[model samples]
Target: MISTDNFTIDSTKSKAAAAERFINLRQQKKVKEFLVKQRGYKRPDFNRMILDLSRLKWTHEKIAFVLPVAGASTVSELARGGIPNFEHGEALIELWKSETRVDRVPREGEWQTYKYEIGQLELL
Candidate 1:
C-alpha cells in the first residue's frame, strides 16, 4: 500500500539514486528486460521494499526509466481526448509494493485493471 503522495521531490530523487544499483542487472546479456519495484505502504505504517527483476520494458518515451506500459497507454488515450491523466505514475508506486517481477510486456488496456497512480509530470 504505497502512497504516491508521500514521495516528495527528495524521495523521488533518492529513488533515482537507488536506480543506479540496478543498472547492472539490466546490462546482463541474459536479461532481456528488468524492472525495479520501489514502493511503500503508509496508512498503517511505512513499509518500503525494492524488487529487482531480470527483465522489464524501458518505457522512457512516456515516463521515467521505469513505469507501467499499460498505464502509459491510458494516459496517451486520455491525452488524445484532451484530458489530463497521471494514472501510470500512481500504478508504478503501487506496483512497487505488490508486484515482484516484470516477466512479460504489458499489453494495451492493462493499466485500467488497477486503481493506482498515473503519469509523473508537471502540468503545463
Candidate 2:
C-alpha cells in the first residue's frame, strides 16, 4: 500500500509548480489565439508625433487655452510628441541653470501638461 503521508512535496517545489502552472495558463488556446490576433495590429508612428510635440513649455493656467491652439486635441499627444524640438527647452534649462528663473527645472508633472494649441505655440 502506498502511504500518502510519507510522500510530501517541499514548499519551494510547490511554488515552482505553481509558477509553471501560471506559465502554462498563458499558453492556453484562447490566450494564444488572442495574442496572435493582437500581433496583427499596426501601431501608429508615435515617435514622430512625440518629437514634434515636445517643443513647448507651458504654465498650469495656460494649458487649458494652449492645447487646442497647439493643435493637440488630447493630453497623450503632448506626452508622446515632445515639445517640437528640445532647443528652446535647452535654452530654458540653461537660463534656469544660470538662476535667471526661480522655477526652471522640468519636473515629472510638467511633461503631462496639455497646454498650447498649434497656432498659439511655435515649435523650435
Candidate 3:
C-alpha cells in the first residue's frame, strides 16, 4: 500500500494483527450475549455446583481459583449482580464440580487452604 506521499507502506502485518483482534473481540461479544440470554435458563449442573460450594464454606477467593482465566474480580462481580464472560463462568463451574468430587480434607485442602498466600504478592 502507498500513501499520497512517495513513501511505501507495509500493511500486511498491520492488517493481520487487526483481523486477529477483531476475531477475538467478536468471540467475546458472542460469549457475553449467550450468558446474558441464559440468565433465565437454568443450568442444573452449574446451580448444583454453586450450592455445594456454599455448603462447603468456600470463600469467594477460594471459588475464584476455579476461574483461572477469569480471576477473582469476575467472581466478585457476579456476586454483586455483574455480568461475566461466558468462558470464565463455564470454566469456574466445571472446575468446581470436579474439585468437589475429589474432595480431600487436610490432603486436597492443601491447595484449597494455602491457595492464596497473601503477603508480598500484591504491589501497592
TM-score of 2: 0.22
lDDT by residue (51-118, candidate 1, tens digit) is 11112222324333355554545434433432223564355445544443332323234433433221
In the order shown, what is each candidate's alpha-carbon RMSD? 24.2, 14.5, 15.6
Tell me the deviation in Å of residue 41 in model 2.
13
Q: What's the CA error at residue 6 for candidate 1, in Å?
A: 58
Model 3 agreement with the true structure over 32-86: per-residue lDDT tens digits: 9999997766432343344346556766678777566446565666655454467
Q: Per-prediction TM-score, please?
A: 0.17, 0.22, 0.36
Top candidate when judged by TM-score against the true structure: 3
Q: Which model scores highest in lDDT?
A: 3
Error of 1 at 63 (Å): 13
TM for candidate 1 is 0.17
Q: Which residue runs does candidate 3 get wrong by more than 4 Å?
A: 1-40, 43-48, 69-71, 100-124
Locate the minimum summed-lDDT window of 10 residues in model 2.
95-104
Clashes of 2: 27
Superposition TM-score, candidate 3 onto the true structure:
0.36
Report every candidate's CA lDDT: 0.36, 0.44, 0.56
**Per-residue alpha-carbon lDDT of candidate 2 for residues 27-117, written as tens digits (9 for 90 to 100):** 7967889989987653333332333334334432343243333443433444454442344334334433343222323343343443323
Residue 13 error for model 1, in Å?
49
